[model samples]
Target chain A: MKLDRRAFLGTATAATATLAAPAVMGSARPHVVVIGGGSGGATAARYIASGAEGAIDVTLIEPSRMYYTCYFSNLYMGGFWDFDNLGHDYGNVALLGVNIIHDWAIGVDRDAKTVTLASGPSLSYDKLVVAPGIDFVDDAVPGWDVSKQSLMPHAYKSGTQAQLLKHQIENMREGGTYCMVAPPNPYRCPPGPYERISMVAHVLSERNPTAKILIVDPKENFSKQGLFEEGWARHYPGMVERIGPDFGGDRVEVRPDDMEVIIDGQTQNVDVCNVIPAQKAGKIAELAGLTNDAGWAPVMPADMRSRMDEDVFVLGDASHQGAMPKSGFSANSQATVVANVIRGELTGSRIFPARYSNTCWSLIATNDGVKVGAAYEPGEDQIESVSSFISQTGEDAELRRQTYEESIGWYNGIVDDIFG
Target chain B: MPKLTFSSILLAGALLAPAGVFAQATPIGDAEAGAQVYQRECASCHQIGEGALHRIGPHLNRIFDRRAGSYEEFRYSEALSRQGRDGLRWDLARLHAYIENPRALVSGTRMAYRGLRDEKRRADLIAYIRAYSDQPQNIPEASPTALRAEVELSEETLAIEGDAEFGAFLSAECTTCHQRSGDHAGIPGIVGWPQEDFVVAMHAYKQELRPHAVMQSVAQRLDEEEIAALAAYFENLGN
Candidate 1:
């Protein structure tokens, strides 16, 4: 409810940034503070800073030393992709005259309307856009704790844990256990666990065909469920098994070690377990007091501004997107929405959001890909999809080729948006 | 000061200001330079020069004066095509604005390229399209614009009627690349295109169907049903 000095300073900085900008475009534009220079943040920064050159200002804030995309993280872990392929740099944001600040958020003072970075500096905004992406609720499970993350690394957000999962996949011998506990419904990248298994099974089958990959799930259905399960049955049968919560498979009381997963009334021994424990907004969201009891911030449709904070807008995995699972693409699209809204606010214009699109591609196998996508728009108070698409069913050789080509194309394309 | 001297000074100032603001209309690059760039960048999907064909997007032969979404075939995203289905012509000014930075000009479009931002580059590109266009020569002269406008004046005489001749004036940009051939590559020629499919596709793209980043970029600029008029016009053209 009240902002500290840093938060106050951030707000003051925004005002200064706003006022300092010439009302008229004499080549210098209004500056926009885009927190989380990921897909959404970077695109907004690039467009406003460059496209509207002499008309807008753009500053990007991201904490990652390097951007490791979740899009192809599964491939990277499966040994099919190199880490560098998924990594992106912020130089493009910088090239466009966008201020790229590599720092995390410590607090957001709604009253003063400022964001206090972990670096202790503050940034004010003509408008503030938060595409901070998703956060893991390390303690989402009743008995689980953050210190025990080593035992169950979600590896979902990419970067360090991504490498952790990759190393485990490499070292584990044949007949070892690969337990990946899926989250309840509405998590980022719904088809992720299924796709991860497919990718792992493909790699493991060739190296260690005897390895059993068990998926512990909390939901009966998933994104493109029919398509994913179909691929498993056709290619790697019995090697990849999913434990349905209703069918005597417990979600997870606790995983004391990477070697075991407890389900129903038994302890299943595991070799390398990847428990994608449930997620909410990142820690900064909680620190900024943006979450409701569910650990998500509610916002008006399309613009993604928190209903509680008008000057503040949230996008990506951080916002409660309802059925829209958090993925970089979704995050990026939401970023476009919020960025457009911020621009409109800065320039005094009306918002015209006819639609927004999200397409998530999962590398089910080394050379194969599966996808589930949807296009959304502002419904009354929230955004909803108007049309959805899925990767064609039954791996036609052509479909498979298209999938791989599309995946590569998408990666290059999105990378272009992020850093190009 | 003499009255003549003051008057002369005022006239000189007026002439210099616009010269100062507009700077110089770009001439270093003609539509020829624009043609080369378009061939290198946009020709893969968009038809830009003489006898243009769409690889992915619609032809841009005479796009200068066409309405935003008035094309009959080569389904445009509902977003951009919707803008002129109601007869909103793509005048030089609007075309330049859209070509500069599509997403800024229209949100919710699927066109992925950030748009060519250099004003001179854009003007040169448009000029190139104007310079290289090879539109239909046999279509007889008819007042498509007036018929459509007169229908609008009546409002009830013909439900959403447009002058085939006048609509053709607006349709020049569209027809150049449309059915210039029965079907070119993957794009269907407009000769026998079904208006329903054409309209629906525009709506879909406007609404985000066939969501290509580039299409999304352009579609977001158009509105609904402007899509319909373009569809109606195309549908009337002998299947």
Candidate 2:
């Protein structure tokens, strides 16, 4: 590794002197630039820095100083966890030798291997990890746009939008209806919309018993559908109703000004409307030309290297690998794989087989939690599921409680793993 | 840099044991093979290393001769606790039977594993578990006929001509929740699998041999050819 570093430095210095490059300073250590500090980017930055043992320099570019995880934001809405608990700072990640920069990455000059930040000097990297998460397709939902977001909050990104949605639910009129316009298929968190509904129902069942929750879903079947349905029937039976694609869930429009949701030919006035629009890879990925026709960067199943550019690796919600959900756990798992690959490439470290796993736990009621999980391996075209398990519908109260507790434990463990 | 301690090196050697063929009691089964079985089947919920804390299940250090549900730190299920009261220790026979089918042995054991139906694999797993015990027990050799039966069953499951391209198209439904790219929170990523292993596993799920309902349904949907294609597709995905 040391020998490679010296050789790389000698070549880099010669190139820099000849090219007069503005981005790189001919440093002896290899630089790794990570864009987006959410689950994927933060974990990748931290791991690359630590795994290389000071052999590589890592810089993380994120617009937000504090990252609020989308994983447990539903729990926050249900009052299970405080809002502050969802926010994580990069103090620990910085301690791991990552240079944390609070700025949005505007563009990627792939030819020059440089990343242009919104407000800073451009940084050059020997390797780059783009994990900018998701960005909504602005016009996917008719009559719904960012300006009208205040009236119909998505709360999917887990920040102020989440807080706004929580406020709307809490301040909703008694006996009023709260409707959610769920996103299309292939979005982040497969079971997120139903989980949000369950959490909202949990709050309404207690505080506003007369209040109703309506779900306008584009997909007919969802993740943990049986479990969610059973839990809803058991806990908040009459309070929630989901309208699938058969019931005009696909042809829905929200009138933010009138606070009305139009499904097919019928329209109903609602006190609160959460419109989660269709989504794609984060904007930075598109700007970098890493995204494919599907708006997600294609990656090799083994190491997550971008199909378009080998020097760049895409992780988490931005990459199209296979068989893994776009969840924080999945991103963190991918980060470990990418970190290992980056370390091996730069520092001559050993790269292990990419064995990935994820478990999504959704809390239906206070202590009623259901989980779906599996162990996976790399396949020919994408990641594939090797084995899987899920909580049974008729599980006892003790088991449900334990499952919820396990989710809490996992949340803490993953946040620590990623941020630290 | 700190110098490597003699004990630390020995510990490392033990952990790095590729075949886990420890020089303890007369080796009945391959400890290394058993270790792999343990990793794939039990490591998720159970721990066996030094200072391993009880997770979903109790740590299994020195588990031989220990009464069922005897770990003080872990809260055992009622069935396991009752068996512990009855003075049932995890001896070779008990471990083999229990691991082969926990619910069958205890009736209400909370361990989520469906059980290892392969007789040889069960023997190997028991042998691995024995290696972790203070008083290692000798595993009785399996009869040639029994081993042959298990091998035949495994071979039958792997007899399929897989097409990778067709498998990729069929994988769309699987990737809906399984995730083709990115982090897998609770879902496992299945890429780069050996074709034979993939086929056998899918057959297990399709035949209602695995405990997971979703996988069972998924496997039931895929015909033998489709399953073979999926196996071929995933098998070629290598690191």
Candidate 3:
């Protein structure tokens, strides 16, 4: 296999180090291994490598060559955004002296300070950052599994599933019902399911106005509930309906074979079913023994360091940090704090106090966007929201349009920040 | 008469001067001409007389010597707001430059007017607006006499040397929305800004003098030294 300059140097250094004492390894540059190159992992890897300026080595292992963000997938479904715009590559990220490996990281050997790859080689690291985003819990939704994903798509993870779901929506029978099975609390993107419902309504209102939409939500309340309810009432009136946990929304079971939803012991036929199951940390974190009984990796509020392993940091949706929602913005924020702490530990870089913030924007209809945001600070037990703001229900159209335009701007800014 | 010194002579002249004359400075242009200019140019979007409330733009009352975007209730464009936070006050020189060409002073200002090109007309308009402001002798803290030293930055705070390395680390948070490459679509670019402008703008956000939620949240957590470091780092970035 052809090797790059850094890889050749690493190999040569390894060979030379075999003849020297084990203590010589301490003198080498500290190596940071980052797993899962989404918002959290990618930002952390970029910051640590760029901030160190050749003082430390970083290797990022991600399975996919192109990362499709989940943040704007709903917009894509709504025909408001281009699907191609959701994809970003690591070409610029690799330029900052990081070893970018497009391979799966299968196991973590924490005691040995090494990570095993799906391809056969085991790479060693001084510190490891696990940012694998999320995995659906088994049997969280009865009669549903990943194998049945083609029949009833989750469309949650970033990939072809979003495309499949959009295709299904487009090809749906005229005047047919579209039912959604929303997940419980503590999921990625709190307003995501409602936003998806809005997008579905937007598409159907144009194609088949008679088509009805049903939501099976387990939570009592959702993010931007008032704003969304008002928009739905005004924009797509009588087209959508919702059932909360109090009304048997909590009792849900999906049958992909027959395309039916069983809610409150009542069977309803649907043309398209979107099932978003309860989630947990990605499987690799569990393999690393970093997850707790709740199937999430608990982290220190200050730095997002794994409570189990000081050298390992868990970020993004997989991390159970308090107050901050599991979002791309929050992940990016936490990654900056993680990068600063890690760089300061390895090299003598100045470590600033940890600060985190997050803002989530959602679109109800064309030029009708709403946002909720909070500033976070580390409290005694967890990260707490210091200040927060949400869009008002009765805001004028001009403000909503401005908010939508700002969301577009934010998308451009964040993608540039992440990929570059 | 009794061996009066220069100070005593000046004091006698001041005492003999007409009351309320020294309360206001000499108008830069004819007030009557300026009133005509205001009617012709600015009457549609702005109002300057007593009891003027916010219209399309903020009410121009007390606008002189006020921070650029400090009329917090109004929804100004991000570009104008950023400049205001960057220590752009409505003084004679700055207001002159702005009225001459709004875009030249602040790029992406949402002021739809092209600009007043005639130097005489712009001065007249500014003189008319300056009538609404409290005189310098009345409000010393916010007066046109304080030019570059308008904002509340102590000499010691400005003197603190910034560490570029630390700034680079902190800038990652900012760059999540504000591009480092100076490509600003909706959010304004912060790259290559003057260090003092950056510091002053950040302090404005920290103090809630500027009105942007994300910016305020980001700035509130940063200390004085961190702000300086970020200012230094962004100032050195190649656009």
| Number of the top-ranking candidate, with lDDT as the measure | 3
Instruction: Output the lDDT of residue B158, model 1.
Output: 22
- Per-residue lDDT tens digits for candidate 1, residues A1-420, read 123433444445544353342221222234467777776667667655654554666667787768888877887777777998888887756777776667776777766555677756565555677667667675655445656666667788888888878778877877898887788755777778777888888878888888888888878777777777777877788887777868655546656553666787577777887877777876666676767887787777766777767777777777885556677777766665565566667665444443456677776654556666665777886787665666666645534544565566666656655676
- Candidate 1 residues lying further than 4 Å off, grouped into runs, are A1-31, A349-351, B1-239
Question: Which portions of model 3 show Cα errors greater than 4 Å?
Answer: A1-27, B1-151
lDDT of 3 by residue, A1-420 (tens): 113324534553554343231221333677798999999999999989888888888889899999999999999999999999999999999888777877788999898777877866666777899999999999999999999999999999957999999999989999999999999988999999999999999999999899999999999999999999999999999999999999999999989999999999999999999999999999999999999999999999999999999999999999998999999999999999999999999997788888788889999999999999988989887899998878888876756776787788888889888896
| lDDT of candidate 2 over A234-333, digit per residue (tens) | 8998888889999899999888999998899798999999999999999999999999887888999998999999999999998899899988878887
RMSD in Å for all candidates: 19.8, 15.8, 9.5
TM-score (chain B) of candidate 1:
0.42
Q: Model 3, range B1-239, lDDT digits (tens) per residue?
A: 12322233334435655556534433355555788898998899997776788898788877777888887688999888766654567776667666766664665689998888787787667666766765443221124632232135678888878899788877877888888888877667789988877887787667654456677778888889999999999999984
In terms of docking quality, model 3 is: acceptable
lDDT of each candidate versus the true structure: 0.61, 0.77, 0.83
